[model samples]
Target chain A: MGVRVQEGDFDLAVELADFGRGAGGIVTFTGVARNNDAGNLQYMEIEHYPAMTQSAIEAIANEARSRWDLCDLLIIHRHGRLAPGARIMMVATASAHRADAFAAAEFLMDYLKSRAPFWKKEVTSDSAEWVAAKEADEKALDRW
Target chain B: MIDVVYFAWVRERIGLPRESVETDATTVAELIDELSKREERYALAFSDRGAIRAAVDQTLVDLDAPLKGAREVAFFPPMTGG
Candidate 1:
């Protein structure tokens, strides 16, 4: 289990088939592209620094492994155009106990939300806007 | 020559993705100040320093981060990834 950044969609079942072979508990989280409140969304365009994406994710994974007793961890994030309901990314963590898995998963999510270089721009029928980073997201990092 | 890059709306406003600049600025802030004086586009894109984030050689850093030995620097909006 490692990190992957690509434009192709991933299969969750296929991804987990051989994941965390010896772990007692595995926790997984998937983020989906959501429709806007107005419900007139077309797609989301995700942009990332190609040279930094992989290493940045690897650093986050290493931090998670350092802070938890993990067996395996996987992070798969997609870039390019994604429509509503399409999966944007996934994080999976395996540990001897469920608590560690859950905590590490959350930690990874919190860090990725702000530290990663990816940006999302939502496109509607007639307008496009970059999604602003929430104040809550930066604050979420303080708890860990 | 310092390789400077931009992403998302920063790139859109700057009208390009990356460039190399020869400069003697000692900090990221000074570098931004240098670029900001180059054109109205640079000034507009960097108008709000609080809304912009800087990275030195692919590692995120403060605006005051030194540029003495930096080869690459990137400026972009706050990340909204998950």
Candidate 2:
């Protein structure tokens, strides 16, 4: 039952430790802003259909559960305006073993990147553009 | 009745982000046809059907998939989530 939409930054170490209660291992991943300096991105805005966004995230969480034996999971993604060096999303997983925890965390991120409904719009100095879906993201999901 | 939603470029193309419509269709494709008839904006939004993707009841679905009891439907471009 760990789903959150927040504007503030998150601490992955704290979240992983908290979810690790009663578990043998905990793994976490945080997606940070990249320096697409060539793109000249001054800022980015993420927008989503509220209800659909939540449902899609939950579905991804359920898919992770089916693929791995886990104790608990957490996901938090920020929306609205964001700048370079800002955190975009985080995933934390706890499991009976380190392998399961690590794999599940990776799986969750791959799925979230491809399947979730969020869209990103980049505001550059010269112009604004909508981010396009990458073929790599689709291929990432096919591995699972 | 189902609430159909659009987002990002799809919303811009269709001139709206959401709408409620009553439909008798049993599949998402059929629903798209019904919506395309409503206005030019919808027609353009759905013109390149291959570029559009759909979800029924919050689950990603193929266009031919049945919408027998779906309460909500969404149409958008291929996901750019990250």
Candidate 3:
């Protein structure tokens, strides 16, 4: 379980340089900050419960590894102010088969999106609002 | 005294991120009731309890959940993480 909650940017190349040695398949997902349809976004600020963030990610990663025969998993989520096109976070999973890797990656993504104790607030020149939890996101968990 | 904390608009409405709360409330819901009676902002923040989520000692819990010797309590809206 390699879960990092940081304010600094991470190097994808360096992170995956030796991600999974024996695993035949590897899947990755990256989320980047973007603008809303109404305005030009200045930045996004992510706030997370410091005490629970790490343990929550570790629990999710552990659950994914248990259900799938995953070799390794990595989760990195960034906080503080981030500009548009800046990376918000990334998730990677590795397994012996493509299906396991893909499934585990999606599982981690869904759980992180809905259950993690992090919140996002989008700031524009005119207004700022906390990003609300989408109904679809909560429904996405039904598949798991 | 429990260290109560708020996040996002919950904090904005209450105008504080954290505070030392003196209380005899045995459950999270009771704590909310106590706080809401103290100020209008707390009432506004806890008005829509369905939209709020509680955490005791950093673990997510329901409002009906017991305090259970908790050192910290957090209240926030449903998460929007990725």
State which candidate, 1 or 3, has the greater TM-score. Answer: 1
lDDT of 3 at B52: 94
Candidate 1, overall lDDT? 0.96
Q: How far is candidate 2 from the true structure (C-alpha RMSD, Å)?
A: 2.1
Name the weakest run of 10 consecutive residues (lDDT summed) in model 2 chain A.
A11-20
Over the true interface, candidate 1 deviates by an RMSD, in Å, of 0.5
Q: Which one wins by lDDT: 2 or 3? A: 3
Per-residue lDDT tens digits for candidate 1, residues A65-131, read: 9999999999999999999999999999999999999999999999999999999999999999999
Task: Per model, state how many residue pairs clash.
Answer: 0, 0, 0
Considering DockQ, where higher is better, how would the candidates rank from best to worst? 1, 3, 2
- For candidate 1 chain B, the 10 contiguous residues with the lowest summed lDDT are B51-60
Shift of residue A78 alpha carbon in model 3, Å: 0.3
* Model 2 lDDT, residue B26, Cα: 85
Supply candidate 3's per-residue lDDT for A76: 98
For candidate 1, write residues B1-82 as lDDT tens digits: 9999999899999999999999989999999999999999999999999999988988999999999889999999999999
In model 1, how large is the Cα lDDT of residue A81? 98
> Judged by lDDT, which candidate is best?
1
TM-score winner: 1
Clashing residue pairs found in predicted model 3: none
